[model samples]
Target chain A: MKKLINAVEDVVVDSLRGVAAAHPDSLKVDLDHRIVLRASGPVDGKVGLVSGGGSGHEPLHSGYVGRGMLDAACCGEVFTSPVPDQITEATKAVDGGAGVLHIVKNYTGDVMNFDMAAEMASMEAGTRVESVVIADDVAVQDSLYTAGRRGVGLTVLAEKILGAAAEEKRDLDALLALAQRINEGGRSFGVALTSCTVPAAGKPTFDLSDNEMELGVGIHGEPGRETTTLGTAADVASQIVEPILADRDFTASPVIAMLNGMGGTPLIEQYLVWGEIAKILAGKGVTVARTLVGNHITSLEMAGCSLTLLSADDDLLTLWDAPVETPGLRWGC
Target chain B: MKKLINAVEDVVVDSLRGVAAAHPDSLKVDLDHRIVLRASGPVDGKVGLVSGGGSGHEPLHSGYVGRGMLDAACCGEVFTSPVPDQITEATKAVDGGAGVLHIVKNYTGDVMNFDMAAEMASMEAGTRVESVVIADDVAVQDSLYTAGRRGVGLTVLAEKILGAAAEEKRDLDALLALAQRINEGGRSFGVALTSCTVPAAGKPTFDLSDNEMELGVGIHGEPGRETTTLGTAADVASQIVEPILADRDFTASPVIAMLNGMGGTPLIEQYLVWGEIAKILAGKGVTVARTLVGNHITSLEMAGCSLTLLSADDDLLTLWDAPVETPGLRWGC
Candidate 1:
């Protein structure tokens, strides 16, 4: 298949350099090291935040490195976690006097790599490192094998809220706590209209006929919770959100809603899906106080969307409102 | 043809409601009038930045509302510009005494509607409104019916940089000028491996065979400038970046590069593409200051990627370093 890359092997590093070149203002490229960070050094009084996993979920790690979000983001090979060395370097880059917090999605490699980096960072004197492993996707009922639900969508929300808290000059403890709150409260579920091809795999991750879709696919394009006949946008949204609402009791509180594109779905359709999702949530008396529609977090070019709902309280709300300046998920005053 | 929406007509409104419910702390939805804003009132002296366009480019407008970026985002229907009423509403919602600046992508409908809204806001007392249109896509060589090149990717970078400028208390004219500079200095090009389905259209925007791709597509699933045999990611990136480099003389200046996913392209592949792009740029002697990889602007289910390069000066870099808080992009002090 034709692509815009050189040898498939050099794709990841070359892309990281390109990103650093493009956003010199907000990001830096460690060509020798594969780390992206806010151009400025870490803030003096605030704890530094770092997060990354696979290379393809663009704007997730790298795009999200800036003022209100990640201090640095490491890109691994596509769908692969950065090695501990990369994460360790990122920790060093963002480590101000304050500690660093790693927001890791619950994927086997991602968890392990980030965990290793955190441990490495902790070994340094005065370097307080902590992690919030986000497993927001409800796709996998069996948490063990599939990294306990495969932290699909909530990573963006968690970064924004936590970035805000960090911007507020909160201590590492408070920042970590808030990150956990956002992650714990948010539940995400996604479906795939088609399977995506991993370059190494060189084919569709799974097969979906014209009239079928895989519900609850992993970010790396793994099989979803179930495969069913293709349904309408509303039906798909319901399938993704129902489980999330059920798990989080979204009906009882106002929620932050995200109808994210699975790389291939257009924003035109994301809004269409969001419209239907609103009706479902309204019917359940779930007050959707805030909503985001479009591809915030994506699964390569999978033709689908995921729904993420973060139940909120005042603190979470305040943190969500905190100001941030990352390439992804920035907001608040 | 199945979609996640209730009725195609109600898509925008319903989606807005869902957004409101989802982030009550960070975003408040004006259901009666579809406008999203930071839940809090306009900051006392900070510039109120407002941007909006068709709904297909998620996290572009709405996902960007917050302290460091946009104060409000008015969302229109899929691939269609928001109406003037919506823009006016968003203006009022975000019009702090500091005035409002509309960050518009260079699309026919978006420019017209935002222009109208700016005029409307002028009529409304105590509101100062200005706009800057971003025409950064270099894919369309022709400057005819489609209003020159469609504003495909640079929207996110412009918003974040200009948003930071606004946050820094730059006067309206300065902010608008900065916004213009970002637009002028940035250029992008793309290639599509597969066409995405527009939910309302209920079919692929275009068709591609198993081994082919369309080059230079717009974010709303619009056709690219040409159709060619699919090529390697490096070749694609070379084509995408060559025009950009040639157009702006990028080899002479520091650049901020982006390898954006057109939804369906996997990150693994994007990295491959990025890696290739970096080599090409490096060979050209272009000093890449920073970079971003992933899906920032996307077309629905389109399996492709775009490359964006923004030539930066010291001022733009400063703004990039400035703190920002938005749902889509965030960063530091």
Candidate 2:
């Protein structure tokens, strides 16, 4: 409730204004449509990459809008899916001579709206738009807002890899195949020590006792696999990593590991958790080729952490290492 | 207190293990001495940069140890200054043929301990060492841990600018003078909505009423200027910016502004605050040539933010734009 915001209704637009103001050289904001576009986007013959979802998980869809990442991001209200209109506008804005690719998370509202937007873009402008839904959270098969597994931490990885591929001027079909490959290979699990409060709600989304944690919690505070007793970082790491490895066998290929923070947890704790997880992976003989530890996809001020493991080949690793200059993720540029 | 930690005693070392694991290509960790060193360090004739302090303000000293930044960072227990021995070892480990420079915050323990380390390095190893102490916080003339002003957000900026300068093969004396100039040109102010709990303490460092906030708070939860009623981001922005601009004349030149989060605040809220701060700066005719908004320097999981503005000329701006490959900050590599 003590958030640094003016009014609840103005939160998304205001934050976008700040984003535009902060990255004037790289990002261009269309406030009226609530879409953030790359300042130098729509490469003449390259497929445009667009992704979006609810607002609270920052540095995700919007913060990733720049060269080598996302061409445009259609921002919705906090924890609410962007309307089809917004997504359509984002699609049209980033459409070059090549087709557009929509990288969407697996939420019912988001999936449906993005589909509608794709149809609208195709019908209105004859623009070919391909949609790739990311449902990599190994938490639950269904959640409060998602019919399938909720797209969690893997979305960030997918965006980075797909963005790099798009920057290489890969056709829409190839990008779609890569996106599906990433979705198939990536798995994520999250634990919430505390629930986040939406600005409009002005109260925590859920109640979690100090000694308890939500195992496999969704990004929007949806019910997880179980409400379990809170344990040490080692215990938490086992709980998170076991389910992820059980769901996907990472031993077959070199893995890219991401130990992501859920807003409220500090970097030191993230590193601590990563250390424990690394030990577990090493014991299991998982070869981690790349590791990222920070708050990439966060649930607004929720104290917890998530783990994402992607089975990566040399190609995926190369794409990940490619220069990316987004506000949220940057490297090798 | 809820934190993702193993044990109170192992927090620093365990976290360092994670850091070393996550950034094997860029960083090397010495667990016995609790020092994070650049994997490729002691560049033949470049002045080595060494900075260290307490452990809690992460990504401050430890995360900054990489190429184009600090050659070494000494890690102490949470909220406790690094021992002279640890600092001396770090100094020795990173001492190139040219010399070494120590960037110390203005905390009494940090300044004193770094000074002792410098003396030890000079007397015992015959290594030349120079020190630059940052006292940029305009919050208070003195605080619980500092003799003069508390070094807050400006340390990040100073380390960055000095790191770039050192990479250009600047000598120890020239880096020291540049550091002092940066310290004089920079000012910082912070606000805390809630207090953070040290792992050993198992409780909050300080308390504020639910409806109140600590204005001008230090990174260690020390008392601030006043406990004021919670206000909107606009109101808070005015309170933060007015004091900073009043204390210095940022209008004389372009400014590099950073709106930094204190761990627990969400990026959305930080951007919202930055939006408000940007409006105020524009109204005041302060030209911001560059801006950074995120959690760079943090106080554990304290829910608040701080702002640092450095007056910049063409030279400083160029250095600020230099490539930095730290875990906490990165661009243009």
Candidate 3:
């Protein structure tokens, strides 16, 4: 590894310093806790949102902090969920009088730790802590053997929408309900084009031949639900969309569509995939009121893409229109 | 190349669908424009903030949209700048009665396209467009080569702070001024432990030996200033921090610091890196008021880290403390 730094151990610290230095206006790095927070406290009378997982998923928990999204984000090592202690500290830091909502993705470790932290926080100070576990990926047809649907790209969408609801002074229960609705309505299925190596793991997450691809992989480099031969963009779209459409009954409703890159795929390719999805949705009489194409959530340098569809309702549309301020997802006032 | 998808061509569109499906409340995919936006009209009288760049750097332009950040974000292909047409459309869409500010990272393609789009928008409507190019990475040392110090990690911070300022209803010129101040005060340097493969390129961005790393790599996997033997956490910090400290006269001043991951490095190692950086900064009499760790900005699965430092003043601190509502960054109310 030909690198530029003086040492490997100092990488995270140096990088943290860089983040602090770069955005002095919006964030303060609590070096002691390795926590990133908005310089001031969160809004009043609204549930404060805090989320985090591994470090590799940038602009995620941290980037999603601000006026309408997360209040603080605790980042762990790359591809590794933050420790319970870190999550505990973040829950404390972000909680105001209104309470704190943890948006935890449904990875095993993440779920375990965040669940423990929520319990601990509640016990610690009678501080109200609520958590919503996002399991939006529809890739896993057999949720029996696996932990469940791996929370992939939908976490980003959940955080933003719920962040807006919280910003709108929705109560903790309301925010929680809205988050669950968004999570339930959303489904994701990802396909990798190439393998990504985790630094600590120091190996490719998985292997695939040039002419083959794995379907329904998790974000942490986990193997897909199955493997398949190479195909055209339209055919691949059919495989991914068919599952999501069938699983969620999106064929009869309006949906918010997304074609997300798995870190390495280019946008030109994403647009092409979008075209295929659009045709499929139109053929099925599924109305796509909105669509987003590009890499929103990623798995390191994995060369692949995922499809997410959200069944949208008028209420959800209103909240989506609400203004927010964070790093990753924002829109309407 | 082992991938998760059935085909390479469907990556982007599939991923976008996943994103849209997950968060129907906050973001609606403008399929025609391939832009992500808040599902409603712009806020009245607030300056419309728009930004974009290559797609690989997540939680970037897209994640930073919301209340305290960008009004809209345009995403390009992986590692490739979004076309001018996209920027033009985003600018038009986000423009509320106020002018628009384009927060562009300092890349040749990004600069050219954003500039062109601004010009094009000017030709179409009276939407006043101002652009601020962020060039905070200090590794390159000289702008004479390689498009100057490539805007690496500082973009995330710049966008959040500037987004907050925009939310504060600052004029476009004031927002521009604040953006410059943030950029001027910030400096960064990165080291890559391993090379990441661009999906379309279908190969490692650069080659590295088992025991070496490339220093000062850009987010797009651009070659860095030098290649060095891998060292410890402290050693890497010294290399990255020394240059940043030398580049600016942050001598004994209070500083905001960041230790950012380049996707692949784990946080356990990142913390060890932070430990070393803290000691060095203390030795240098640099008052480190805040620090951030983990991957805020990344370059796919490149294993490495970046260091950033910003000299902080009361005004910058105030802006950093302001409320924001984007999906990526959040804070004060």
Top candidate on DockQ is: 2
Give the Cα-based TM-score of candidate 3 against the true structure: 0.64
B228 Cα displacement, candidate 2 (Å):
0.3
The DockQ assigned to candidate 2 is: 0.86
Which tens-of-lDDT digit does each residue in B1-333 have in candidate 1? Answer: 645566767777776765665566777888776788899878877888888887766666787888778888888877778899989888877777888888888888888989998888879855888888888888775343258767767888888888888777888988877877788788988888877666578787778887777777777656667778777665677778777877888866687777777666655567667777777888989887777776677664567788888889988877776776555565553
Query: Is candidate 2 or 3 superior in DockQ?
Result: 2
| Best by the lDDT measure | 2
Each candidate's fnat, listed in order, reads 0.58, 0.77, 0.12
DockQ-based class of model 1: acceptable
Each model's RMSD to truth, in Å? 5.8, 0.7, 7.3
Which candidate number maximizes TM-score? Answer: 2
What is the C-alpha DockQ of each candidate? 0.34, 0.86, 0.13
Q: What tens digits encode model 1's per-residue C-alpha lDDT throughout A246-319?
A: 77687767787777777666555666677677778888888876677666777666678888899988777766
Q: What is the interface RMSD of each candidate, in Å?
A: 4.1, 0.7, 7.3
Query: What lDDT does candidate 1 reach at residue B163?
Result: 80
lDDT of 2 by residue, A179-295 (tens): 989999999999999999999998999999989999999999998999999989999999999999898889999999999999999999999999999999999999999999999
Per-residue alpha-carbon lDDT of candidate 3 for residues A1-333, written as tens digits (9 for 90 to 100): 233334444444455665565456777777666678888766667788888888665556666677667788887766778888888888877777789999988888888898898888888867799899888878773353238777888887787778778877788888888887888899988887677766556678778887877778777767777878867776778887887877868865677777777765544455566667777888888898766665567675567788888888987766665676554554442
lDDT order of candidates, top first: 2, 1, 3
